[model samples]
Target: MADGASGLGDQARAEAYALPLEDLNPGDPELFRTDTHWPYFERLRAEAPVHWCKESEFGSYWSVTRYNDIMSVDTNHQVFSSGAALGGITIRDARPDLRRPSFIAMDPPKHDVQRKTVSPIVAPANLAVMEPIIRERAGRILDELPVGEVFNWVDRVSIELTTQMLATLFDFPFEERRRLTHWSDVATCLPMPGALCETEDARQAELMECLAVFTDLWNQRVNKPPAGDLVSMMAHSDATRDMTPDEYLGNIILLIVGGNDTTRNSISGGLYALNKFPAEYDKLRANPGLIPNMVPEIIRWQTPLAHMRRTALVDTEIAGQPIAKGDKVVMWYVSGNRDEAVIENPEAFRIDRERPRQHLSFGFGIHRCVGNRLAELQLKIVWEEILKRFRHIEVVAEPKRVRSSFVKGYEELPVVIHA
Candidate 1:
């Protein structure tokens, strides 16, 4: 079933998307910058949950803003395949062969096997072993925040904790943790036009450099005997039988990028939300048990990753909107988080609000984020540590958002810490 309205011509679709009160110019590439999502997503979700967008740099695509529509696309992976385009998931049309293929972009049976291989490591049983270590690290990170002084939380604390934990999972050498973190940042920030490098050639080189570093790391891990870690689990698992070395390298990059960035974003984003809503902050501080409820509220308020694009495999209609096969349909999680129908007073950030975690920040369906529980765990423990140490935390400077639209939360978040 195609959407009721046939696919409009480029001009008409663009005109339809030209709404008032939008800070973004959908006609420009910045509207779909790979680093950040708020400006464009805020506009689209407010104006058109199912609107069309086109930029000279990235071409045309349909943006799904409604919660139900986004959920439909996310759930119906068959009708809306992750494997549609040759390039990877971002809206920017990546060069087909140059883009690394991860299970994140694979469809069906292949995705199933790959996901299964790594799922056990993140299962409740294994993650239980990590809880104490994670709690200790969280305490150290928060406790070390300069008392009665201002510090940049994003770089100094948030990213450090997330990537360090990921390093532990891979058993990466301590000195190499920062490099792996840098690689994840580069891979996710690819669609940003000049965030890292000026030219496409330079961008491709940087990407390959990250891939090569990851490949070297994976080969070393494979050569060694099995260990009780994610790398060893994947290497020894029967589920990965047909997986080639390249695919392992690709998926390793995927897991690192996925695991590191999103959790880092959640931590920093949670800080932002608390600062944004002092009442909510007060609530959490007064009743630390509210931390559980606050976790979802923070995710909802942050809506960190924004939108993920899925290509229509077969023609389909969603919410009376017709989507053609191969058409790129983007589900705007940021908008879905603010959906009025699903969330009462969606704009309000209330920690005590029931079901605060209902926002589609982790997405839905088969491709829903796998490290979601871990990310939530990190947020919980980090906040617990923060509350135990600091009586008051306030933003000292305006936060800096990433330049790209893909993996977004914060680049610089300076905060004044009070004991």
Candidate 2:
């Protein structure tokens, strides 16, 4: 639901403002599902940058809402741990027996080493190598679209491009590439009675199948020489080679979600945001060179993957608010991205900002997104290709957003291309 809807956004805004600061639960997935989470975050940022929620669906947690405060919390990894033992990165805590440790979810030493193993995939040389491939693939995807007919942009372009690239990264089977998308969604989704995933047990069942499939891939790759693909890299590298079965699955989920959701949603969000702010679209069409800047601006505007949660390793005070030991501290990147103190006109989707990249979307410090540059490159290439073929991509309807507050993304965006 877009803001300023007759009842939804205005009602949410009123409730958000009227609620006692301590009672506000911005992490509620329902708010995000309806796109009404904005005003709640806005209230927290303005009134309680370091607010405490005594209760939530996840549990009691501390919210660090401002830009600098989030930076402080994110960078100070020693004080705030991302260990799977404490709880993984998102607001949702996994069951004790199911806690799987990925590089992004581990503390230093192990986290550093495993992250380094796959870092080469997105290095400048690798990105340079992949640019032409991305551009060519993006062109083909766009070229095939019907000019006058409406289609779901999320499935047609966003999912197709990100999944294709993710398949290439993992050297996954081309025909079953959509499984990557499915697994990514399943990994971040909340298990509710009426939801896509009915229960935790059902979710685990699907994930086990993912592990089994990847296990086959791993077994096939282990005896071979070291290769460029992620599976081969993990199979060969000392840092990742001896990982436990659960650790292996954790890293696989991280890679799939990292490589799939962020870029995929941003691709859809860019078109949708531009459509929201038509002048920005006009500016982009007049000067396509603004794309490099526009890409990050869209990332900032979208703030895909809204928040990253960390468990307090020790007693710490964030912005003068005391956070006890073992407390969950959630850095609201979606809120921070809109912190007026840092970003001028934080709400507007402007393509030409003096410093468009100066926002906290991919995150900060040691745990920052490893594939951020790749995400930017994918978005840049798609838009570059899009501007070449289509005069406009008109939003046929309001996009269906993913329900989870963590993975801020689109489920579907209906649109018609004007060529």
Candidate 3:
């Protein structure tokens, strides 16, 4: 467990320590919301790296907690399918009634073709084009921060910047950019009070609105010359151009959620992590050049999206644990990022770690995050711009974490920026 786990309530810590290893259910959303899930995952990694929970809110699922075990499952996508027809790439099974099919939840050949269609948007060439724009936005965001006053960094800085970048990617209307964030939230949120929606029906209706809006964009772009934007790329590519309405909507949700959550949360998480480890923040202040290397470390520490699930296509064993066909196998990237066997001093936040990118925050195999380089590029530029302007960004209160085991991120982070 990270040293920060010590900050958990004494009774909670005692309970975590006393609980039987088999009784440790790491999927509990309350643990994540309270930011006290570390001890549960710590116990899991120590006792049963490949453990099964007979039942839970999502249903029975197997958790692969350690680093190598997660790698084995993540790399072997053939054995552990990501198909929506099977169950999709989340612990929760896809609804048979409301099936939204996207490439990430697809098996290869089809997955490969569709993934290739949008690959160029985040390619090295496109990221190079995007760098200046990202830096400019980062600078403006930082410059506008209220000096020595409390503000929600998650909303003002993280969401705003990432949403702007998402707008640029899809050539979305700047005025209605918040809708992208709303749809992204609604897609992943578990439909609770204070969440994006309060019911499954509400989630679906908002997503349908998202589909309608994007469908208009698709119609407009499909008739024009091919351009560099993501919508344009999808409209022009033979592999993706002919997608059905549901498939198109699914892909849009996938791209929007992918574009919004990871980077936005990491932006917020990086600051929070630095504040939690003041020494690391001091190291960053002293040597700003570490920004490039530190970005991946932040991603590793944050492990933005906690886990990705795969349904077993056939009987398989992960680390000696037999997984029956159709069983849900969740590769807990959150745990793997902290596995002591793979990461040296996994608890501490160090800016100058060797092999910083050697983390599973991005999954392995063909389904590795397509926008990874773009994400890293955004973080690097933001940190660089922040260093130039601010002397320190202090976390004034505990962040209000999103109440979902899946999207491990902040809903709000109160901070005071010092120039």
Candidate 4:
């Protein structure tokens, strides 16, 4: 059932079309885990780009399916709020006692200043400086991989590479960098019986541990001269230096997940997309110069971190569908990225598109991903290094995808390298 860019079989596709429009609930995490959410989104974009669901496990919400409608909702933050107090930015509402404030979940002046503190880490000059370092590390990781034996690419390359980069940015303990990955997974994964943490209390306990470890690092850097790391940047900045413990943990989880999950999943997703569309893989192999363009296209095809939610602060209408005050509006970026009306031949994964960055993966508006440039740089360098070393990194099996709808990523990707 694990698939990306694979055909939804006839029966599955029919089931999606056969559903009563009222029964469509794209927010279901099971649909994502099995990679069968495409047909439902396809139906929505065609039939009701701004559809209403009277009920769902996450409670009733409006789904904005097309590209322009999503843009309208994402950019007009005044009408659509992301305040943590207003239930934050995801479909799942955090328990009242558990919600914490982070810039992505805040609006206006506070969001502006706090975001500025972390923005410099991904600035052009900084990205240029980090490029060679990323390239060198990427080479080392690829060089270490076994050629003939199958291994989980998600663990071996994707996670290791992104975790190393996260450590570099945070100046986190070298050997303990994997802890960042664990914290990120715990932050986003649903607390179901088989998931990372089975209870919200257990999840909170682990997050507290994360806060404790980062608090120690904060102490170390608070008194020292300001340095280049994210930890130091926040410790020195007025906007975030005095954040409450809960607020600090909120931002930490945001940064860890933002910096780790998105890029690592894209790293894994890009490889999976290419393997799924072998013609594109051949195109990449034929023209290594295309890596620059291919990076963004791969991101478009994957659309990691599927949907970002917002709460309507006032009455609004998207695609003529009425949304009242306090309504939860979920922008389906996964669907928008594939809207045929927006991109030419979106269903086809081509490496050399003329306008590869036009997709909505990084989103549009004030809350657009802060570390987006860093992500692109990481992917570009990784692919560049990959093309130099191997003809193909064959996906020997369908990826074992993560269970949550929030984090559209792989838990495992079995693969073997061919020289």
The clash count for each model shown is: 13, 0, 0, 0
Is candidate 2 or 4 superior in lDDT? Answer: 2
Q: What is the C-alpha lDDT profile of model 1 across 370-417, one tens digit per residue?
A: 988888888888888888778788876557777555565687888877
For candidate 4, write residues 76-113 as lDDT tens digits. Answer: 99999999998999999998888899999999989999
lDDT of 3: 0.90
Q: At residue 80, what lDDT does model 3 achieve?
A: 93
Ranking by lDDT: 2, 4, 3, 1
| Per-candidate TM-score against the hidden true structure | 0.88, 0.98, 0.97, 0.98
lDDT per residue for candidate 3 within 1-419, as digits (tens), equals 02444557665767888977667778878888988888777878988889888878888899999999999999998899999888799877767977778999999989999999998899888888899999999999888889989999999999999999999999999999999999988898887776668888888999899999999999999999999988999999999998988899999999998998999999999999999989999999999999999999999999999999999999989988889999999999999999999999998888899999999998999999999999999999999998888888899888889988889999999999866
How does residue 145 of candidate 3 score in lDDT? 84
Model 2 score (lDDT): 0.93
lDDT of 2 by residue, 1-419 (tens): 24344488788899999988989999999888899998998988889999889899899998899999999999998999999999989898999999999999999999999999999999999999999999999999998898889899999999999999999999999999999999999899899898778999999999999999999999999999988999999999999999999999999999999999899989999999998888999999999999999999999999999999999988979988889999999999999999999999999999999999899999999989999999999999999899888888899788899999999999899899876
Model 3 TM-score relative to the real fold? 0.97
Query: Which residue pairs come into collision in candidate 4?
Result: none
| Number of the candidate with higher TM-score, 3 or 4 | 4
Give the residue spans of candidate 1 off by over 4 A: 1-47, 191-194
Q: What is the C-alpha lDDT of each candidate?
A: 0.73, 0.93, 0.90, 0.91
